[model samples]
Every structure is written in C-alpha cells, then in structure tokens.
Target chain A: MSIPARTTEVIGILGGMGPAATADFYAKLVSITPGASDQDHLRTVIWSDPTIPDRTEALLGKGPDPTPWLLDGGRVLREAGATVIAIPCNTAHAFVPRIADHVGLPIVHMIGEVARYLTSLSPRIHTVGLLATAGTVRAGLYQEWLGRSGIHLVLPDNASQDHEVMTAIRKVKAGTRDDTTTALLTRAARRLTARGAQAVIAGCTEIPLGLSADAVDVPLVDPALILARALVSRAGADRTAR
Target chain B: MSIPARTTEVIGILGGMGPAATADFYAKLVSITPGASDQDHLRTVIWSDPTIPDRTEALLGKGPDPTPWLLDGGRVLREAGATVIAIPCNTAHAFVPRIADHVGLPIVHMIGEVARYLTSLSPRIHTVGLLATAGTVRAGLYQEWLGRSGIHLVLPDNASQDHEVMTAIRKVKAGTRDDTTTALLTRAARRLTARGAQAVIAGCTEIPLGLSADAVDVPLVDPALILARALVSRAGADRTAR
Candidate 1:
C-alpha cells in the first residue's frame, strides 16, 4: 500500500495495558505537542483494548500470556494506518519484539527513549534509580537497554518493591491517589537518591500519575513523557524524510 | 457486513476538537467502566485528527465549515467497525446530524444526554445555567434540546460570556490553567447562580477541565462526564440488545 503524503505521521498507540496509564500518556502527548490550532497536531489512532492479559503477572509466571493480545492490538493499529507504534506501558515492552515481528511496524522504544533523554540532559547523568513493577525489574528490560549505554541502574529493594512501589501502582490503577500513596512513593524515591542515583525513572506508567517531580529529591523522569516526545520527533522525521 | 457476537461494543470516538478535551473524555470512559482487569474494559478506537476545522469559529461564522472534516472522521470510524459513534466536543455536536447522515452511524447525543441526566437528578432541576463558548450559546444547541423538556436555560451575561467564559475556554485550549482562569470561571458560575439557576452546566468540554464542581457554589454539572456515562450505558445496551 502506498502511503499518502502528509505533514505528520499517523501514530498508532497500542495501549490499555491499564486504561488510566494510556490516558495519561495521551494527555501528555496532547499537552507537549506545540499546536495552536487542531491541524498542527499529529494524526493518531489508539487501540485501547483493556482485555490484554496483565504483563507483570505474565512476566512473573502468575498469569496467561499477553503476547497474543499485544499482537492483536498491534494488528488493529496497523490496519488503522498507524505508521509507527508506541506502547505506553513499560512492562508491556517485554512483548514488543514479538509483536513487532508479527505486526511489521517500528515501535518507538520507551526505555531507549528514556536512556537517550537522560543522557541528553546537561551534566551527563549516569546513575539512575528505577521505580517500576517487579516484572519489569525481573525481565531486565531497562537493564538491557541502559547497559549498552554504560548507565548504572539502582532499583528499589525487594521489600520496598513488593510493599511500597507495587502497592502504590495498584492503588493508582484502582483510582486511589492520596497522601498515603504520595508518602510511600516519596520514601521510595528518597531511598534511591540516597543510594547515589542522580535521577529516578518513574519507569512504570502508573508511578508518574501519583509521583510528580516535586515529590522526589532527584529528577523524576517519566518514560511515558519521554516516549511521547520521541514519537513526535519520529513522526516529524518521517514527514521530513518523505 | 455482520459484526460477530461480542460482549463489548467497539466505541468510535471522533475526537481532537482541542486534543486535551478528547483525552479527558477518554479518561472518563476508562474510569467509569466497571472492570477488574485489562480485558474487562471496552474496545475503543479513537481517531484523533486535530486537523478538523474549529467548531466554535464555524458556528459563529468566524471560520470555515467543519462538516467535511466531521464527516470524514465519522466515515473513518464507520470503516473501522464502530457500531456506534461519539463526538466528545459539545460544539462539534452542531455538525453531528450532517456527519451522521454521511456515516450512517448512531451518534450518542451529548446535549440530549445532558438533558436526560439533568431530569434524572433528584429535586429535578427545572432551571439550569450553561457556561459554554459564544458559538454554542449563540447556536442555541442546549436551548433547543432543553426546550423540548421544559427546562429553562440561563446563560452568562453578554459581557461575562465575552470576557470570562470565552477567555477561559480559549485559555484551556491553549493548555493554560492558573488562578486567573479559575477566578474567571468561578465568577461566571456565580453569575449563573445569582440568576436563580438551580445548577450550572459546564457545557463546553474545556469548562469542566478548569472549573470543577468545587469551584462554584451551585452544583456544577460536567457535560463531558455526563456524555461519557451516556456512551458507556449506550454501549452496554448495544451488547445486551445484540
């Protein structure tokens, strides 16, 4: 199929890993795009099927495989004319390679984008703390991506991950955001910063919704935000290439 | 073309009349749906083409017609297997009849839903104020819908509409939210309440984003939230009917 000439690329978002996180990523996409009028923004299609099996549970061998559902969502996006695909959930990235192989679309890598963004910042930060789901940690998704760049990764201790970070993520998914969640996340961030981490990656999509930059002592990097920017730049580059 | 038997309806959102509002509506849809896991939520296809012409400007005769783009969006949704369609923007509903004619899909009527929701409230609001764009006010969209139900519609005064409501709506479109904007909206809500309006409708999608129920003394009804609920109910009904 011959793609039509357009000023912006059609971005296909394979989302709904958790409905709220997908919505948060989209809100950031809208906010960050510099557009005074409607036409200035990118053409986008979102396939939000919340039916995909939980990535974290699947990663931990506690649930069904999510690969089929991820592939199905990617197919939906591809059929919808998405020139590029982006998955907002960090844990879902574990299935990207398999999905990409099936769907045949370039996915803007979320972790890679965060690594690039962190390195781009002034002072050339190296050590970063990760506050993410246990699945993402066990899968070594970020570790694999950042290792090639010689960046050090600091993770929440197992207890902190199991009790604090994990609890906060579930609360957010259940639509609970209060001082308790904030305090739990803050303590986790402090532990990371005290471990000599220059910055913290709110690696889980739900984390950014509850934990803001001000809440952490170190810079709290949002992978979803980084991925959104990367998608925009990729779309712009596509326009220029055409 | 026969749709296969499914438990959920495929929701087609024709969005991007100011992208943030579309994101807000989608977020509400996600939250309102009763789902414990990823697969429990509805399958949604959002075509966010911000290139559509400005609805308010078209309604007010200040800009080009948005009907073509609206039709195009509707057709895209219809082609994508959307059994029912929804337009999140209030002003965009002005062109729905024409778009529905073109796409032949039933659009969940936003204003009609608001009218239904208002009547469903206890104590049964008879008089309601609307804080919306000048185009929506002048177009008499709500007045026409509420008129059939014998519900009286109060509006912001001419000066307040121009200076406060319109300015606040524009500020929201530009992604500006601050004390000044909040004050403007709060003052407008007070003016409506002062006119004996039992409740105020945040008729414009942008209004609910900046002016929440707590911002005003009188009950502030968010039309977007109402529409989201209406769409969900409609989708659920579709499943049962099938």
Candidate 2:
C-alpha cells in the first residue's frame, strides 16, 4: 500500500528438525512477546523444512550431515528479509557453527542463551541435569556451554540414554504425549536428581512437550523457552536501537 | 548435501493478521498431519507480518486498504519458494480477491473449505451460525460461500455482534484467553442455536483460542482447523500427482 517503513527486526526461524517442536517454539515466542495486540508483536518468518535430515543421526556418524540443509535454510531466510535467525532445535545447534558463517545473518544461539540464563538465576544453580537426544549429549553442547559458567552438568546413563531419553523423544516426534512419555522423562529426571542435580534442563525441544516442571523435584529449565525469551528481548533491543 | 528429493508441495502461510492466530493455525496443521515423524510433515513458509494494517478497518471503510500489504506478503512467500498460500485470518479473506491474482500462488480458500466441510458432515447441516470479525461478516464471506450449498447462515444481531463477538475477538488478539472471553463467545453461540442453527462456525481464527466445541450445544466448527486439513490433503494430492 503505502511506502513501507523499515521493520526494526524480522525474526527468522530455521526450524522443523521436528515440526511439532518448531510450532511450539513459535507459539512460545508469540506468547512471551510483551504485546497486547497483533500489531504489537514481532515480524516472524518460519521456514519449516521437515525434510532436513535427522541431526542426531548425523552427529552419531550413522547418517548424512545436516550442515548443507541448515545452510540452505539459512539462505532461504536471509533472502526472505530476515534480519536475525533463531534455530529452535537443540541437537541442531551442533551444526550451527558449520553453517553460521554462510547464513549471512546472525543466529541467536539457543544453548548459549541458556547458559547466560542460568548464570542470571536469582538462586545460583550448580549441578543441572539434562534430558536430551543422544546427538546433543554426544556433541557436548550443554557441557561446553554450561562448563564455561562453572555449572556442573549431569546426564543420563548409557542405558537410560538409549531407552528412556531417546525413546521419549521418539514418542514425542510420533505425536504422542501420554503419561508413559511423562513417566519415561520423569524416571530419567529422578535419576539425575538423585545424583544431586538442583535443576533439570529439557535440553531437547521435545523433552518439554511430555514433561513439566512439577513432575521433577528440581525446577525444569526449558532451553526452548529460554530461546523464545532471548528472541523477544533481541526483537525489543533491535526496535530501540533502530 | 544430497539433492532435496523434489518437494511434493510447499505450503505458504500468508498470515500475521494477528501473531497468535497464525501460530495456532500452524500448530493445528502439525497436529492433524498423519505423519509420525518430522519428515512426514509438509514443507511450510510462514510470513507473519503483524504490521499488516487492520483488515476489519479496511472493510469498514475507516482504515487504509490492506491489499498492498497482502500482496507484499504473498510476494515474500512466493520468493521464498512457496507453491500455495494459506491465510489464517478470516477477515483477511475479504481482500483475497484484490491480491489473489497478483500473489502468483494458489491461495487455498479457507471459507470455501469450511463450507465444503460442513456439507460433508454425516448428519448434514442445514443451518449454521457464524462467529467472526465484523469485517468477515460485512464482507459476507460465509454468507456467499455457504449460500451456494443451499445452507442457511444465521448471524449475531448488531448488538450481540458488537458487544459479544467483536469484543471476544479483540480480547484474544490482546493475548487474553480467559473465562470471560469464553463467556462472551458462549453467549453469542447460545443465541444462534436458539434461532435453529445446527452448528456454529468459529469462523475467526482467534475464536478457537477462547471457545472450544463443547462450550456450545452445537458443534463449534473451526475454519482454521478445517483449513489445516485441507492444506494437508492438498499436500498429499500433490505428492501423488508428482
């Protein structure tokens, strides 16, 4: 219609490592935005290519790497006028570095934001438990980030990782979020708490779908939610900076 | 890495009439999809520009024309490689004709799909009530489509449409989906049922956020959900056709 005014920031979601998780992340981003009406919310472009190969399989060296797919998605967002990018999947973060330079837009690092979020907590958190895909654990994504902040990271054992964590993630991907899914996550989380974890991190985006904070004794920290908050904050900063 | 197997279909969402409703529509699309894994879902590009001027205001002759904004969003989706466009907002359909030819993508008609869906119901619906924005109501979107099927469409009276229906839609866009919103919508539906409507259409995308099907005596038909199903069906047909 009229000459377009410059948008302060346009959030590009490079998602669909899992379709449901991507949808959840976008919904959370919309929810946490401090707007009263549709006009007050941020501009968002979501490119959800579910055909992207599984990140966990790639990280485990059993499948083709997803780096090329991530790079292509990033370029798609850039061409669509995205000022910044946000990847909602945790395991996919392992490949972010490989594609970040080629994407042509700054990506809001989800795991890095989680590390900073933990450091800013009112009550200091020391030992944190993680419930994530084997790929994330194998990549040491949380270990590397949290280790920098002096926070200890606890993880499920090999058996639990194979049976409980991975199975629960599979169930969520299959669109099942029943009590059994919650029980698998809860059993895995309980084991971590017994090892002295003060708060549990739902490192994998699928983890939060089946498990809630009250299900575990410790505060359930959701990295996806943290990523959403970080994006909202980034959008606001971009608006003011402009 | 490997060549993207010819994507059977790519869905473009022309949205951001309000952010939450757009998010809700995507979530519903994901939920209804028959696939158990991420790869089973369709490729989607969502361009949610919340800055798109008010559709209702334009239809009411009190605001700037939104056709330019709609056309711009359609172009963004097309450039991003979307094959077909799905608009989540009911009111925005009022301007679909103005921009459809120019958008260069097959726009899935949400209201037309809703009319077809109602016709397909087993018991067969004769009379349907509509809960939508004043813009969609004034545009006669449901009236024109449903009339072709020989279906009777009942509408909220001027007083009820202003006080109950429009207010409820506004509350949802403002991010308030409380019991009060439900109450307002429920009251509106009850009046329509008393007037001999068999089912009520949650024609506005925002209405489903506050009002569920069980809240009213008649089935609360959600055009957004129906649109999601239609998109999924289209994707499948495209896959087979290829």
Candidate 3:
C-alpha cells in the first residue's frame, strides 16, 4: 500500500456529555469544513464517553466531579496523536481548564469562540443574550468570556431561567422538540431581545437542536457552530505550523 | 487520576467518503445504542478522511484507487486500540476485504447487515430493491452477499439509475436535500416497487438523508441504521467475550 503524506491536524474531541450533542457538534464540524473529497476534512478522533458525569449537575454540586472522565477522554485523544482538543458541550468547558492542564493540549475554547464570533458580526453585536443550562448560567461561562471582551450578556431572569430555558433544554435532551418547547424558547429569546439584546447565543449544545435563527428575531448564534469553525481554523493553523 | 477498567470495545470507523454520511452514521450509532450515561455508549474512534479517493469513481475505473487511504485509516483505528472497524460508506465497502487483510481487524459488514435486517423483518422480505451509487451496483456487493442468502435483488432501470439515484446521491453529498431531489428519489423507489420489489434498501449512505420509511410505500431499510446496530452488537459482544 502506498503511504500518502499526512498534512492535516488531528482534532481530539472530549465529548459525550450528551451523545446527541456530541453528534451534533461533529456534524457541524463536517458541514463547516471546506473539503471536496474524503481526505480534505480534518482528521478527527472523538472519545465520546457519554459516561462523563453530567457537567451541569457537577457545576451545581448536584453530581460527581466530571474532571476524571474529562481527563480520561483527553488522554485518549492526546495518545491518539490529537494536536489540539475541543469540547463540544458548553457546560463541559467549566472543567476544560483542568482537563487542559492534565493533557497539556491546546483546547479550542467554545465560549471564547462564541465571544469572538459575536464580535465578528457585521454590526459588531455587543448586547447578546444567552440561553443556556442553569449550570452554565450559574457558572457564568459566557458572561466571563464576553465580559472580558466588553460585550454585555443579557440573561433570562431567574424565573424565566428555571421555567423556560431549563425546561426547553431538558425537552431537547429527552428528544422532544415539539412546538411547546420551540414557543417557550422563542418567548425567552424575545424577552432577551426586549432587554436590548441583539442576538441570542444558544449556549447549551442541545438548545440549537430546537431553536434556530428563524425562531428568534435576531441571529441565533450557535456555540457548537462557532466552536466547529474555531476547530477548523486551529487544525489548519497547526498544519501550517508543522 | 484513577484508572478505570477498560471493558468496552472501541469501534474504529473508516469513514469520510462524504463527510455528512460519516456524521450521519456516527449519529445513528449513538442513537441506536442503549445507554443511560456517557460510559454506557460504546467507545468509538472515527478516522474521517474525506480525502480518500472517490470510491464510486475508482469502482467505475474513472478515478484513483482508495485502497491506500482505506488501509491508512484502518491502521489509525487499529493503533488506537479499536478491536473492530466499520466503514460508513456503502461504496467504500468494496475495499473492505483488502483493508481487513491489511489491518487484521474485524469489520462489521454494512451490506451484510442490511441483508440480515431484511431477513429479520416480519413476513420475511424476499424481493429487495437497491438504490445505490453506480459503484455499489456495478461491483455487485449486494448481489454477491444476498445471492448466498437466497434473497432476490431488484435494481432501478439504467435511466433511473443515472438520472434519479445518482442525482439524489450527489445532492446529498453537496449538502443539499431539497424537494426536487426528494421527489426524484421517491419516484425511483416507486419504479423499483412496481418492478416487484417488496422493500427498498436505501443502499447508499446519502439515500436515507432525503428518503425515509414514510417517503416510500414499501419499507425503506437504511443500511446505515443496520450497520450501526451491527456495530453496537459487535462492540457489546466483544466486551462480553473479554
């Protein structure tokens, strides 16, 4: 057999917080990549250990630490020759710093990418709304990243967060995306828009499955898509660096 | 970090004929597996090399050979500790024997699984229609396998094969699944059923993206789903054997 030149970067995914979300992220990675043939895409190694303890539950102190599982997934990727890593789930990013510390591989930060993507928008979107899980909201992932970039994050009020956003996220996880979930999420986006938000960031990976740009008035920025783009760029840059 | 027991089988995928099909297959793998948490899902390693030369073109003697790339992908999976491998693309399976020979890893046969799935159906499906790429049809991958199992195979007329089946498959690869493509495929399915096909196998990976059980009168057996089930079963069996 002839050996072809290996010219692309291998992307290791620390995933499986929710299997569907991991699949969604991979699908986005394939969609956003500009490749004509089978070899044109980035070499991706996905360690989808759906057994990684719940990130949101862990963040809320209601579940076991996911650090061990995240680290294990990272090690699998690193040992598999992944030059860079990406975590698809937003809440999972809470443990990424620790995971990165353990694996010592560059992680394409999902929240940081969302912040960067929002900044790159045509009108320079500043006031953004976040519709994420309670754990991610409580952890202030988007708030911390976007705040550093001088972008204001408008979140749903506590009542809305508990009733609409969290409920919608659960419905999405349970494989239910009925009109009720869509209407509820749309209302939440409208409330954020009313609060002077320019666009809604589907911070939780599952949120984008049910809510889309058409469901909301302003653009619905998908962190998964943003992360996928960031990964492609990182992989391409790594190839050039090599 | 605690070293958790490695009990599950790792499924290495030789994929990326078209990136979307590979993603679709992985998603089906996740969806069909019986899992409660991340660890409940089978450990999967996917080497999605979209750069693998076009399998259809190669089989038609019109493009470069993909065997080298397939072998390379299999080697990646094998070195990553994959006990067994699966190829998502139906056409790519034409090179599986050579790949299996090179890697010395068991590959969950996609077409074989489809034949088995049809046999398992209630009332026992006898005449099966195949809607696949010209490569799969020309290579007689299904005929050779199903012939042994005593199942009858019906195919689309040459005109429909080139116009409808090929066109629909190309549209799916281009990430376009519009009404026009759907209609073209559904018409082809009707023609196959009219020719005495009891059920139509969405033989090509891209067919399922636009066509479903509801789209056609006869049962539309999806090879991807069948392959996913086979992979899950194989992984579970491997774990049990250990």
Candidate 2 residue spans exceeding 4 A from truth = A1-7, A237-242, B237-242
lDDT of 1 at A131: 96
Compared with the true structure, what per-residue lDDT tens digits does model 1 show for residues B87-202? 88888888877766778888889999998888888888889999998888888999999998899999998999999998988888877677888899999999989989999999
Q: Please, what is the whole-model Cα lDDT of each candidate in the order they appear?
A: 0.83, 0.89, 0.82
Over 4 Å off, model 3: A1-7, A234-242, B1-7, B35-40, B101-104, B233-242
Over A186-224, each residue of candidate 3 has an lDDT whose tens digit, in order, gives 999999999999989988998888787898778888988
Clashes per candidate (backbone, < 3 Å): 4, 0, 13
Q: Against the true two-chain complex, what DockQ does each candidate achieve? A: 0.50, 0.75, 0.48
If the candidates were sorted by their DockQ against the true structure, best first, what order would they fall in?
A: 2, 1, 3
TM-score of chain B in each prediction: 0.94, 0.95, 0.94
Q: Which whole-number lDDT from 0 to 100 does residue A202 have in model 2?
A: 95
Q: Which residue pairs does candidate 2 place in steric collision?
A: none
True contacts kept of each: 0.67, 0.81, 0.55
**lDDT of candidate 2 vs native?**
0.89
Candidate 3, B207-227: lDDT as tens digits = 998887898888888889888
Report the poorest 10 consecutive residues by lDDT, candidate 1 chain A.
A1-10
Per-residue lDDT for A1-242 in model 1, tens only? 22223454888888887888898899989888765555667778898877677889999999988887777778778777788899999999988777767888888989889878887888888899999999999999999988878889999999999999999988787776688888889999899999999999999999988888998777899999999888877767323331
Ranked by TM-score, top first: 2, 1, 3
